[model samples]
Target chain A: MADAALRRTPLHDLHAGLGARMGGFAGYDLPLSYPAGVMAEHLHTRAAAGLFDVSHMGQVILRGERAAEALEALVPVDVLGLAEGRQRYALFTNEAGGIEDDLMVANRGDHLLLVVNAARKEADLELLRAGLPESVTVEPLDRALLALQGPGSEAALAALAPGVAGMRFMDVATVTLEGTEAWVSRSGYTGEDGFEISISEKAAVRVAEALLAQEGVAPAGLGARDSLRLEAGLCLHGHDIDAATTPAEAGLGWAIQKVRRTGGDRAGGFPGANRILRELAEGSERRRVGIRPEGRAPMREGVELYDSADALAPVGRITSGGFGPSVGAPVAMGLVPAALSEPGTRLHAELRGRRLPVTVAALPFIPSNFKR
Target chain B: MKYTEEHEWLRPEGDLVVVGITSHASTQLGDVVYVELPEVGTVVTQGDEIVVIESVKAASDITAPLDGEIVEINEAIADEPGKVNEDPTGDGWFFKIRPTDMSQLDAFMDEDAYEAMTG
Candidate 1:
């Protein structure tokens, strides 16, 4: 285990004062939960509003002449079409159609803003530096990012940035928050209407405190964050999609633009375009499927999925599994044979020495509340 | 009743010993979300890992206090693991055991000694 003193977020003191159970995550000593506990925090986020300090996520700026062109070579997303003050989800892919990481690319007026997973930040930076054209510049914004999510998030953010409620999903704007200039986005990992505020390390404490002071907003930790994202049907890096998986297989085909398809203008341009295009045309051999366990026993990650036949042939392996707070049941996503990926397809998950019955289900077990 | 340094408490119940977690251990572990107990007929040696307990934060192993055969397990903990957090040393008793050797009890610490060690 890394030493607890190694890294600290801006909310460290505030979380400690609130009696939070501290844990090491993404190189920061962050709260695992407050005194209200994980279940309460999870339910709180689903019901009203919850504040999360995701400052550990890597924020970067790609600027200069070839920034957009250079970034286009790395991911399949159409970055050139993204208007200023708009954000889109993109994936970092290897030459073998494997996902390096998933990120949010925001078109800041002067530079392209990229927000990536905390654990994969260092490697992602290295990949960008090596592949990005020399004319483009990459700079890391080592600061605090806070996510205010749930139904009441719109009103909470509107209180700080007037007219922010008019911004649609995936829209970014630079707004003055508590007299400090910060970037706010109508986007979040939780399948709820929310905003992600990017503030300076020094200003994060004030912003978080100001938000938490509002009605129906409480501090949530990584534990609740995971459950919320899972219930939202979002794929977590390293768990749901890794180097071994492709975007198509992970059910993220919607993210790939129609212009990048086989007969389109930008055909065969991005890395892994050949394999990715093939998978886009002809489905992958294995695909990620949501599994609903028959009983309350949670089928965890790495558990094998077996066919119900007498031989009990192994067909897939679970990637992410946990209790879905909104659904009030145990749900999981697994990489199963493409034939068995259809919803309602019955399968079994091997737990301990017994095989538990499971059925494939539509993801986001609870319907997403995104502001369409 | 006596407790082990591992924080398991064992109480004499006729020829059997009823074992459970200590209050100190429960409080340290936070909310108990799940519990996996050994089968009734499973044979366990002293210091053997006999149960798996999980909180939302992490999972931990609960060891057997002495060499014994599990005679009965508290199935209630399977459904409501929080019972362990509510009364770890009393109503949260995990299982009863038929000791393989009565001399194993000598290795355990008494209530006063256990309390002093914890302090």
Candidate 2:
């Protein structure tokens, strides 16, 4: 086991002062929840507002004349077409067409801001350092990122930064807060209207404290964040999508630009282009689909999926599954044969030696509330 | 009545000792959402994994405090595991056990010792 004293987030003291249950997460000692518990924190995010310290996520800035071209060599997304102040979700792929990591890339004023998962940050940075051209400088921004999510997020943030209310979803803006210039993005992992604020490490605690003072804003931890993202039908790295899974099979084909798919002007140039283009045209052998358990019992990750008619043989594997706090039921996403990926297909999840009936459902178990 | 270092309490009732999770253990676990109970007539030894308790944060194993056979289990926990969180020492009693070795009970910690260990 790793030492608990590995690293501490900027809000570590604040969370401890609030009597939060602290735990080790991605090498950082983070809050799992406050005294209100996970259920209350989860419901608070769905109904009102919830403040989350996501500073553990990796933040990198790429700068140079050919920054977009350098980034395009590693990712499948069309970075050249990304307008300033716009953000897009992209995947870092290997030469074998397998996903190395999933990230959110935003075009800042002169540089590109990339936010990768916390666990994969180090590897992602190494991959970029080795792959990108020397002209592109990849610098890690050791700042703190906070998320204010749910229906009341806009109103709460608008109370502090008034101009934030006008920013559409996936829009990024540079705003100054109390003399500190912070990057605020109208984006979040939770399937709700929210904003992700990136502030300097020194000002992180102050911003979190300011947001926590709002009417509906309650401090949420990783526990509620997992449930909330599960309800949102987001794929968690390592659990849902891994190095063995390709972007096409993970159902992230939309992130791949159509111009790049066909032999257009900027086509067949990125890493794993041959395999990715083939999968784009012919489709993948397996696809990620949403699974809704028939009853309350959750079919967690790593559970084997079997045909409902003959529960003995395995046909797929559950990558992520859990109880959706808002949906009030057990929902999951699994990689099954494309034949079984269709919505309404009947399957069974083997949990604790018993087979539980599950139905293939649409992604985003709960309707997304993005402010598009 | 006696307890174990593992936070399980045993109450002697005729030839059986009723087993339940301690209040301190339940409080630390927060809301009890599910309980995996041991089946009746199953033989278990001291320190063996018996019951499984799950909260929102994570799942925990409740070990057997004495060598015994499960005479009866509280089926109510299957329907409402939160009872354990509300009153762990009362209605949340896990199961009644018929001791296979009475000396195991004598080796267990007493109420004062259990409280001191937890405190």
In candidate 1, stretches whose alpha carbon ends up further than 4 angstroms from where it belongs are A1-5, A309-313, B41-43, B100-103, B111-119
- The local distance difference test score of model 1 is 0.87
How many Å off is the CA of A261 in candidate 2? Answer: 1.5
Candidate lDDT scores, in order, read: 0.87, 0.87
DockQ-based CAPRI category assigned to the predicted complex of candidate 1: acceptable
Candidate 1: Cα lDDT at A345: 96
Which lDDT tens digits does candidate 1 get at residues B16-108? 999999998887776677788999999998878889887755568899888889999999988888799888977788999999887788878
lDDT at position A255, candidate 1 = 85
Q: Where in model 2 is the C-alpha error above 4 Å?
A: A1-5, A308-313, B13-16, B40-48, B67-72, B98-104
Tens-digit lDDT track for model 2 on A1-372? 235676888888898899998888888888888888787898999999999999999999999998998898899889989999999999998888888999999999699999999999999999999999899999998899999999999998888888899999999999876567789999898899999999999998888888899889999988889988988888898988888888888888898998678776788677788888899889999999999988666667888999874656899989987767678666789999988899999998887777878999999888999988
| Candidate 2 clash pair list | none
Clashes (backbone N, CA, C under 3 Å), per candidate, total: 0, 0
